[model samples]
Target: MNKAVFPLLLLSFSSLFPAHGSGNETAALHRRYASAATEMHRVQVAMDAINAKLICRGCKIDVVDEIFSTDFRLKDQNSLGYDGKYSEAVYFDPPKDLNQTNAAPERALSYRGWYLAVKFDKNGELIDYYLTNIHK
Candidate 1:
């Protein structure tokens, strides 16, 4: 084989089969997130509380009252589940499959312009969550 051709082939092979380090890193991060589920849930609840407060202000409802009235369904729910990959951000769709009898105005609010993005440290501690519009 020509020297030039050999180097080209080697380069192509390298690109086709990149290192496994990134996969391992992703798995480690996922494990971190999994083990810290309780803490993550707390962070999620706190964020939901903040969203409830924001909605209540414009709707003339008590903040505490609004919280229990709110319901969340993942806007990207299909992108999550058993095959879901770990991600730092996720969005919630409007609530559905309700009995209607217990539904409240706040429960039907749209999260159209917002997304929930979370940051975690190497230890998987909750750093913070950002509620911002999608970057188009």
Candidate 2:
């Protein structure tokens, strides 16, 4: 075969069956993970804001409003298990003790434990948000 033709044939074969360790797929996955991470950060920030507001008023009603406005659906009648409408879901821990912290003079409410979960779709859209312990 002509030298030029041989190289062209090889190129076509390689394209049909890409060799292992090729960087393309890995790069794409990396991009997806990075995008998801950025979105999770945004959700976390928003949840933090809502948490601050709830802690300030110490009103269960206000907390519920803040949660629902953020696209969260309360799972239980007690207002626990808040679920987000976006791809990500957050689970907040119940308040531990009623200890007062100097950070906020209005009211000091201690949180038992809080957690945030982020779920992403193939298109990278947020699907769910969750918050727990609002009633507890």
RMSD of each: 17.0, 17.4
lDDT of 2 by residue, 1-136 (tens): 5998999998888555313322443343334433544445434544544444321222232233234233433333343223522232333433354545657656555544444443323332333435443434
| Cα error of candidate 2 at position 47, Å | 2.7
Tell me how many residue pairs clash in candidate 2: 18
Q: Per-residue error at 90 for model 2, in Å?
A: 7.3
Give the distance in Å from residue 48's predicted Cα in candidate 1 to where it truly belongs: 3.3
lDDT of each: 0.40, 0.39
Give the TM-score (vs. native) of candidate 1: 0.24
Query: For model 1, what is the alpha-carbon lDDT of residue 85?
Result: 27
Tens digit of lDDT per residue, candidate 1, span 11-82? Answer: 988654313233343344334434444544434443544443322212211221222222222225454335
lDDT of 2: 0.39
The number of clashing residue pairs in each candidate reads: 3, 18
Q: Could you tell me which 10 consecutive residues in candidate 2 have the lowest summed lDDT?
A: 54-63
Segments in model 1 whose C-alpha atoms lie over 4 Å from true places = 1-47, 50-87, 94-112
